[model samples]
Target: MKPFDFVQPTTTDAALAALAEHSPNVRILCGGTDYVVELKHGEQSPGVVVDISRLEDLKSIELTDAGLRIGAGVTHTEIMAHPLIAEHAPAMIEAAHTVGAVQTRNLGTLGGNLVTCVPSMDSGPVLLALDAQVTILGPKGSRQMDLSEFFVGVRKTALEPDELLLDVIIPTENLGKPAGFIKFGLRKGQALALVNAASAFRVEDGKFKDVRIALGAVAPVVMRASKAEAVLEGQAVSQDLIDEAAKIAVGEAKPIDDFRASKEYRNSLIEVGTRRTLQAALEAANG
Candidate 1:
C-alpha cells in the first residue's frame, strides 16, 4: 500500500468536514474488518484514511418515537448484547451472530457492514425485513432514505463519497414485529453466505398481514421477493401456500454459477431458505 495521511476526527461535524475536504481521496475506517483487508491486499488505495472508530457520537442503540435508533458505529457484539434489541429485534441478534466470528463481530461496526454493501452481508436481511431507514450526514446536512434505497449494487451504496452514514432506524410500526433470518454457508464458521433470507409479518385473525421477504447473495444487491410475498400475504397460513411462496421466491432470484456454489444449488437454497424463514417468523408471530 502507498503511504497516506491518517486523521481521526473527534466530532460528527469534524468528521463531516474531513469527508467534505477529502472524500474521493479519503476512505473512512471504523471497524477495519473490511477496509483494512482491502488496504493490505491492494483492493483499495485511498490517499487519506479517516478513522472514526472511537467517535462516541455514532455509538448508541436507543428507542425513539420513530422506532429503535441504531448508531452506525454500534458493533455487532453490541447489537447481540443490547437488551432493547434482544427484546424488540431478536432476529437482528441472530443475524449479527452469523457475521464473520466472535472477534470480527467484536470489531466490526454495523455501518461498516452496510457500507461494505456486499450482497451476502449478514446484517442486511433482518434490517431490510424490518423496513429500516438510514440517516446520512453530508456537507449539505442530513438526509434519510429507506435501507432498500441505500443499496446500489455489489460493493456499492447510495452513499456519496462525501457522505457518512449516521444511523439506522427500524420504523416504530415494525417494532417487535415477528421476523426471522437464515444464512446458508458451506461450513459453520467464517464462511460467506451462499444464500441468506429473511421474512417478517403479522398474523391477524389467522391470516397473514404485511408479509415481507428479503434475500441476499442471489442477486447484485440484497432484494425483496415481492412476487413471493404476494403469494401468501393476506392468506391463511398453510403448508401448500408456504411451498408455493418458496417456489416463487426461487423464480425471483437471479443466482449465478460460481466456484462456491452453482446457480442451481443457490436457487434451491433460496426456496428452502425463504420457506423456512417465513415459517419461523410465522411461528414467532403465533407464539
Candidate 2:
C-alpha cells in the first residue's frame, strides 16, 4: 500500500474540515472493507486518508421525523441486529446477511457498500426498492439526493472528492413497507451476486400499490425495473401477472457476458429472482 497521511476525526465537522483541507487529494475511510483492498492493490493512492470511524454522528440508527435514518458508518452486522431496521425494513437484514462473512459484516458499512458503487453490491437493490436517500457533507455544507442519483457508474458515485456521505434515510412512508430481497451467486456464502433483486409493494383492495422492483449485477448500476413495476402497479395481484412482470424485468436489464456467468444465464437468474422476490413481497403484504 502506498503511504499516506492519516487523520482520525472524532466529529463530523472535523472530518469535513479535514476533507476540505485536503480537497481532491483526500479520501474518506469508514469501515475500510472495500477501500483498504483498493489501497493494498495500488488502485488508490490518496495523499491523505481521513478516518471517520470515530465520528459518533455517523454511527446511529434512529427513527427521525423524515424516516428511518441510518448513519453511514453503521456496519452490516449492526444493521442485522438493529431493532429499528428489523421493524421498519426487515428485507435489509436479509440483504446485510449476504454481505461477505461474519468478519466482513462486522466491518463493512452500508455507506461503504453504496459508496463503492459496484453493480453487484448486496445493499443496492433493497435500498433502491425502498426509495432511500443519501445525505452528503462538503465545503459548501450539506446536500441530499435520492439513492438512485447517488450512484454514477461502475465504482463511481456522485459524491464529490471533498464530500463525505453522511447517512441514508428510508422515507417514513416506506418504513414497514412489505419488501423482499434475493441474491443469486455462484456459492451460498461470500460470493459476488450474479443477479440480485428486491421488490416492494402494498396491497390495497386486492390491487398492487406503489410497486417497486430493483435489480443489480445486470446493469452498470443497480436500477429499478420500471417497466416491470408498471406492469404490476394498480393491477390486481395474480401469479400470472408476476411471472409476466419478471419476464419484462429481464428485458429491461443489460447483463453482460462474463466468466462467472453467461449473459443468457444471468438473464434467466434475473427472471427467476424478480419472480421470487416479488412473490416474497406479496406474501409479506398479505400478512
Candidate 3:
C-alpha cells in the first residue's frame, strides 16, 4: 500500500471539509473492502484517506418525510437485520446477502458498494428497482438525485471529487413495493455475478402497474429493462407475459464476453433471471 495520511472524521461536516480540502488528491474510505484493496494493489494512490466509517450520521436507517432514508455508512449486515428494511424492502436483504461472504459483508458499507459503481454490484439492482434516490453532500450543501443518475459507468459515478454520498432513500410510494432480486454466479460464495436482476411493481385491479425491471453485470451500469417493463405495465400477469418480457429484457442488455462467463451465457441468464425475479415479485405482490 502507498503511504497516505488518514483522517477519521466524526461528523459529516468534518468529512465534507476534509474532502473539500484534499479531494482530487484524496479518496474517501468507508468499509475499505474495495478502496483498501485498490490501495494495496496500488490501484489508487490518494494523498489523503478520509475515513467516514465512524460518522454516525451516515450510519442510521430510519423513516423520514421524504421516505425511508438508509444512511450510506450502514453495513450489509445492518441492512439484513433492520426491521424496517426487512418489512418494507425484503428483496434488498436478499440482494445484500449476495454481496460477498460473511466477513466482507460485515465490513462493507452500502454507500461504498454503490459508489464503486461496478456493474455487477449486488446492491444496485434492488435500489434501482425501487426508484431509490441518492443524497450527495459536497462543499455546496447537499443535493438529491435519482439512483440511476448516480451511476456513470464502470467504477464511475456522478459524484464530484469533493462530494460524498450521504444516504439513499426508497420513495414513500414504493414502500413495501413487491420486488424480487436474483443473482446467478458460478459458485455463489464470493462470486461476482454472471447476471443479476430485480423486478418490482404495484398490483392494481389485477394488473401490473409501475412495473420496473433492473439488471446488472450485463451493462456498463446497472440498467433498467425499460422495454420489458413496458411490456408488463398495465398488463395482466401471466406466464406467457413474463416469458415474453424476459426475452425482451435479453435484448436490452449488451453483455460482454468475459473470462467468468460468455456473452451468450449471460444473455441466457438474463432471460431466466428476469423471468424468475418477475415471477417472484408477482408472488410477493399477490401475498
Query: In candidate 2, what are the lDDT values of residues 60-137, reduced to their tens digit?
Result: 999999999999999999999999999999999999999999999999999999999999999999999999999998
Q: Compute the lDDT for candidate 1.
A: 0.93
- Report RMSD for candidate 1: 1.0
Best by lDDT: 2
- The digit string of per-residue lDDT tens for model 3 on 4-90 reads 999999999999999999978999999999988899989556999999999998999999998999999999999999999998899
- Total clashing pairs for each candidate: 0, 0, 0
Q: Give the TM-score of candidate 1.
A: 0.98
Candidate 1 per-residue lDDT over residues 1-287, each given as its tens digit: 76779999989888888888997998899999998888888755698889988778689999999999999999999999999999899999999989998999999999999999999999899999999999999999999999999999999999998889999999999999999999999999998999999999999988889999999998989999999999988998788898999999999899989889999999999999999999999889988
Runs in model 1 deviating more than 4 A are none
lDDT of 3: 0.95
Candidate 1 weakest ten by summed lDDT: 36-45
Go through the candidates in order and give each one's C-alpha lDDT.
0.93, 0.96, 0.95
Ranked candidates, highest lDDT first: 2, 3, 1
Residue pairs in candidate 2 whose N, alpha carbon or C atoms collide under 3 angstroms: none
What C-alpha lDDT, on a 0 to 100 scale, does residue 243 get in candidate 1?
91
